[model samples]
Each structure stands twice: as structure tokens, then as C-alpha cells.
Target chain A: MSAIERQFYHFAFDPASRVVRMALGEKKLDVTEIAVKYWAPTDELLKLNPSGLLPVLVENYEDGQTVVVCENRAILEHLEELPLSPRLWPVPMQERAEARRLVGWFERKFDYEVNALLLYEKMEKRLMGHGAPDINNLRAGRESLRDHLSYFESLLETRNWLAGRSMSYADFVCAAHLSVIDYFDEMNWQKYPHLKTWYMVIKSRPCFRPLLNDILPGVTAAAHYKELDF
Target chain B: MSAIERQFYHFAFDPASRVVRMALGEKKLDVTEIAVKYWAPTDELLKLNPSGLLPVLVENYEDGQTVVVCENRAILEHLEELPLSPRLWPVPMQERAEARRLVGWFERKFDYEVNALLLYEKMEKRLMGHGAPDINNLRAGRESLRDHLSYFESLLETRNWLAGRSMSYADFVCAAHLSVIDYFDEMNWQKYPHLKTWYMVIKSRPCFRPLLNDILPGVTAAAHYKELDF
Candidate 1:
């Protein structure tokens, strides 16, 4: 098999992109990272993806030929299909569907309630000259987090992993988003012991080492960000 | 093989559920329908699905055997795995990924903007006990729809189907969401000729026939809701 050249375009602060980056690292795929600032949308990136979203992968770029893949979940699935990469999805149809479902659950439901609120209310303002934070929305987001966390706790009580018995893309997709929330000192680890334990296991993995060091402008991770047993 | 008993709980107001219903019809699956009003948020249904969402398919009733599938995209994928159902996903890995991505795009991006605005603002007030419409959000959604429509137009211009040359789950997923918005007369068909033409063809299919006759409480579809040439 020939070596594949890949380029990943992502924003520094975006969690979805971060998840894709972590997956790439896990797969040991060499990729060039192009930074994108969401506040200032560029025409070139817009041409590549009209959705105006981050974490797009361009594969086997050779002057005129390139295949653009958008959506972080799709990118992860694409990488898993490659023979060189470590298997990130379970083999059984039931297990694979469950993993994919959890990925979607985090990306859609958790991201909307937690990541979007935190980014727009807390982070985006610092970067984009937006006005004061919407306290009501943020408060509601925080309140909603408790329920979601409890769900995670119950999920963790049954299995060592998020999706199933095996480690899969679902774990990365979730940890990627949660790490962003953790950076803001927003997650209440005490309330979710099982989740905390699961997170620590993920944090210790070599694949997640680089993620702990990611520094965003005007935003600092929690003091225990790098601590595996926080 | 013993006959598999399936029960589908859905609401007329839900476009996602409608897609599942259409797929069931096409596959000729013998399933019983239990109408559910999404706004009520019943504890019974909530027990079945912690998400409290509609379109939950319960398969194999004897001995309490059941599989609860949420997220319309995931549910459709699960249905494809059933023994007697017609396959909606492509055989090739790349093509399947493309189809799934389009399904996600329609469900998350397009539905979030278009259906959320049109249904929640214009229709939900009458069905549920929601407050008056937010005109600003509705207008913003309409403006966003123009951008999404243009993307769909470009997509339809290149391929006979939404995801590729063959009709797949992606087409049903998109058409399902669009049909909901079209019922409210939210889509400006003249602005996107290709998408409009493509929608007309999908709407005329036998599987889509029930959707044309669907009636939401206190809300009537637009005058041209059933018109194939519209």
C-alpha cells in the first residue's frame, strides 16, 4: 500500500477538531494542520466546505487531486477504514452501531447543551469581541450538565469503556468534547465518580498526551488538566 | 425464521419519524404504529428511551425482547441490518460513508435551522402551549435556508440522487426534513431549481405517499402540500 498524504484544517479551540486530531494521533497517520479561526471565516475554507464547520480532512493531495471529507465523525470513520490504522470501531454490527450512536449522542446532544454554551458564552467573547456572556443560557447549560453527567455515570458503571467492552471512536469523540469543558473548569468530577475514573483512564493513554498540552489564546485549562488522577 | 413483531411509536409532526415510516413501508415490514405527541413528554415513552424522543422501534415482542433505537439516522442504519428489509445504504465503504454524512448533515444542520424554526415558531404554538413566535429567529432561519438550498442545488446538479447516483437513505433523510418545511410553505422552490426538481421526484414516490396525507393537530399543510409538480 502506498503512503497517503493528509491535510487537516481545524480551529485551535474547536473540540470536534481536537477529537479528530486525537484520532489521527492514535492511528499514527501523518497530517498537516491548518489553523482556522471561526470568528473570522475565510473564503478559501468556505470553498472547501460550505457548512462553515471545522475538522475537514483532505486525503492524498497531489497538486490537482484531493478528496475533501468533512464532519469529524465521518473523518474518524474514514480513518478506521484504512488498513494501517488500529481498529477504532468494533467488528460486530450491533457493537459498531452502539459506538456510532454514542458518538452522535455526544456530538449532537452534549455539544449543543455544553460545548456550544461554554464556547459562545465564555470563550467566543474573549476571541471575537462579543458582548457579555449570556448568564441565563450558561446557567441552564450547567443545570442540564448534571443530568447528562448522571447518564454517563450509569453508562460507566456497566463497562470500562463508553460505548462497549472495547475502546472505540466513541470514547475519543466524547473525551474530546469533555476535555474542552474540563479546560474551562466546568465539569464537576465529584458528582460523577465512575465518569471521573473512566476519564482518568483515557487521560493516561499516550494518544491523549498531546491533547493535554494544547494551549488556546486567552483560555487556560484547569490546574489539573494534565493530571491523570485528578 | 419466525415472524418478527415490531412496533413503531411516532408523531405526525416529526419528520424524522416519517422517514422511518416510509422506509418501513418500502421494506414492507409488518409493524404496528402507536401515535405519540412529542411535546407531551410522557414518562412511559421516556422510560423506553431516556432521550424522550419519538420514532422508537421495538422489535420482537415475545419474552420481552426489544431493541430501542433512537436518532433517526441510527435507526435507519439498524433497519438496513434486518433480514427482510431493502438495503438503503451503498455497498462500497466510501459511498456508504458519503450517504451517512449527508444523513447527518440533513438531520443536524438543515433540520436544526429550517424545521426548528418553521415547526417551533409557526406550528408548535398551536400544537403545544408554547409562546408567540419569534419572528427574528424565523427570518434568520429562512435566510439560512437559502444558503442550505443552494448547497443542495449544487449537490443535485452533480448527482441523480442526493448522496450519489443511486437512491439511498440519504435521499429519504433529506426529503423527510424538507417535506416538513415545505408543508409550512417555508421553502422558496423558485430559488433552487435543481433541489426543487429533485424534491418533486422524491415526493411523488409511493413510499412518500403517506407523508402527503399527514395532518398535524391545529396545523394544516400548505395548499400545494400534495402537489407533485410544485
Candidate 2:
């Protein structure tokens, strides 16, 4: 008998990679994490994924075969195919669609409307040696974030989870993006009580622990980031 | 027993919607197409998908149940769940990952690098009444397009399909994007022999006929756009 070894190439604070990390934890799949500076992706990373996008998952089966899955959409689908307990997608069709919709929301809509401005200005600029955050972009991004938070709060007011009763990939997608933003101390947690409560519960899950300790050099996470209850 | 009523809200030139159109065609599913302006979405469209993105699918089951799936990723996943004949995702794990990776490529990286500039300049600007296209942006976008085309050409030179042996969603995704670009007379088919051959074969499929006839007002397609062979 042989083991299925896995290696994950990802960057800390990358929302996409963060989702993958949480899924890996939930699935209890042991993998070696290889941290990479997303701005200056390595040759090996580019070889595995021509786009040099994070994160890329390379799974090595003992039979000398390797499978490389790149980015969030591909990686998540690949992971879901495994016969593991605690499904990331819900069992019911409608619920699964809801979960998938929210996941797409974070991937395309939220990332563009929020992270492209907020994360790029705050985190990516510094990492890419492009200097400090732009105040105008930061303001716009925060405004967008508030609008998004309110929307999420409304959903949470009605349902137990973002998608519905089940804790699915939608929750992780939200948590992943929000966690990265929270690290920059950009969120006004008090404004959305429902979202704040949801965050507290989501971040406390054992799968989220590793993410709390993830440190990007010279960048400090929010003061309350590590706390289980805040 | 009542029939399943499906309504697809989409814009003609939208690459994402085109993919969905082909999927519906391949599955031989009956659907009502309600064309909407992607730039200025209607109230009903916004109600179904708050993001106001193209290609929102509304399914009204015979049982009086309704399900709405928004955007490409969600819509594609929802469609795949049905007990349909043609499987979009390849059966083998590695091949499926390849198909998914290419789909994600078009969704994120390609959309940003090429469509954001090229389509926005050539097509979207005209639709939005944003005035003439910027020459500099067009140059940059064309350069990026050439690079991407070369990459795809190399892949096609070896594999029968974009994702290897099986004809999967990867082919649809590629054809969708390229068909849109080719409509604007941007693609130089003679340069990439393999890609041209592949495109001709793909576009000649029964499902692609409707897309070939799609016309945007005040914009002319390439001279050879609708031809089965070029």
C-alpha cells in the first residue's frame, strides 16, 4: 500500500488559495505547503501552471502518476471528486446551485468589485515593489466592501449559512475573501452584526486555524485576527 | 406531466453565454432565449442575478419549483448535474482537470488580459456609446491575443481536442471566446494552421450555427465570419 502525496503551491492572503487551504483542512488531506510570492512566481510554478496563478495542487499517487490542478475553480472541482466526508457542495440540487453561485460571486464579482482595488492597493502593490496604497482606491474599495457586507448580512439574517442550512464552499469563499480583507483592518465589523457573528463562527473552525497564523513578511494581520471570539 | 420550461437570459456576443448555448444545444434541451443587452441589463435580469452578468439560467420544473443559476461557472455546473447524454467534463481525472483549468483560464486570466481590453475596445465600447476604440489599448490587447493564440495553437498541434483525447467544455470555452473575437475580424487564421482547422471543425458543429448568425447592431462581422470553411 502506498500514500497519495500532495503539494500545494500558494500565497498567504491570496483569497483563492485560502479557500483551497480550508478545503484541504476540512477534507483532512495532508499536504506539504509551498509558499510562493505571487508577484514573482517561480519557474516551477509557471511550469505547473502557465498562468503562474495561485494556488496549484499537484497530487502524486504511489503509482508514479501526478495530477496538477490549477486555480480555485479547477482545484475545488478536483477536490470535490474525491470520496471524502463533509462534502464542500451540498447534496440537494438547489442547495448545491446556491453554494456554487456564491462561490462564483466571490471568484468573479467580489474579487473585482472589492479585492482588485482593496487588496491590490494594500497588499499587492507593496509585494510588487510598487509603493504604498492609493488613498482614493482604498476609499472606493472600502465603500464597495460595506455595500457587499450589507448584502451578506441580509442573506445571513434569513439563512443559517450563506447558501442555506448547510455549511458549504460558499461559506469558505466568503470567509476566505473577508479574512484577507480583515487582515488589512479594513472591515467595520460592527456595522453588520450578522456577518460579524458568522465570521466569528467560521474563523473558529479547526480548518481555519492554520490561516490565522499565516504571516506575510513585514505585513501585520489585524489585532483581533487570531482571537476565537472578538 | 408538464414539460420543463427553461429561460436563458444572455447577450449574443458574450463568450460565457455562448458556451452555455452550446451546452444546451449538445444536450438537446429545449430553451427559450431572451436576449438582453449585457451592458444595460433589465430589471428581471437584475432580479435573477444581482451582478447583472450575462447568461443567467432560470429553470421552471414541472413540479412548480424554480431554480436560478447565475453566470458561467454556476450555470455550467447546474447544467452538468442533469441526466444528459453528452458529458462536458471528461471521465478521466487528469483530463477533467485539464478541461476545468482551461475553462477557468477563459473565466479569469483570459477575460482580464484579452477581453477586458480587446472586446471592451472593439465591441463593448460601441455598445455602451463610449466612443471610438483606443489604438494603444488595441495594440496591447492584440499583442496579448497573439501570445495566447500561440499557446493554444501549440496545445492543439498535439491533442485532438484542447483538453486531450475527449471533446469537453474546454473546446466550447475556447470556441466561444475565439468565435467572438473572430467576428470582429481580429483572428489571423492563416498563421495558426492547427488552430484554424480546429476552429473550422468546431464552428461547423450544429450547435454553433446560431452563434455564427449573431449580429450586433452597427457592428459588422468579418467577411468570412459565417462561412463553414475559410
By DockQ, the best candidate is 2
Give one digit per residue, the lDDT tens place, for model 1 in A1-230: 43368788997568888888888888888788888896676897777666677878877634444566777866776676677557887765556666777877786688887767766788887778888899987888788778888888898899888877888888888788788888888888988999998899888988899788888777778999889889
Please give each candidate's TM-score: 0.88, 0.97
- Model 1 stretches with alpha carbons more than 4 Å out: A1-3, A61-65, A84-86, A91-95, A131-138, B1-3, B61-65, B81-86, B91-98, B131-138, B188-191
RMSD of each: 3.1, 1.5
Q: Which DockQ-derived CAPRI band holds candidate 1?
A: acceptable
Alpha-carbon local distance difference test for all models? 0.78, 0.90
Give model 2's clash tally.
0
State residue A201's C-alpha deviation in candidate 1, in Å: 1.1
Q: Candidate 1 residues B58-133, lDDT tens each?
A: 6764555456666576678667766754688776555666776787687668878776776778877767777888
Q: Tens digit of lDDT per residue, candidate 2, span B23-137? A: 9898888899999998899999988888888898888888887888888888887788788878999997888988998999898778999999999999999999899999999
TM-score of chain B taken alone, candidate 1: 0.92
True contacts kept of each: 0.18, 0.62
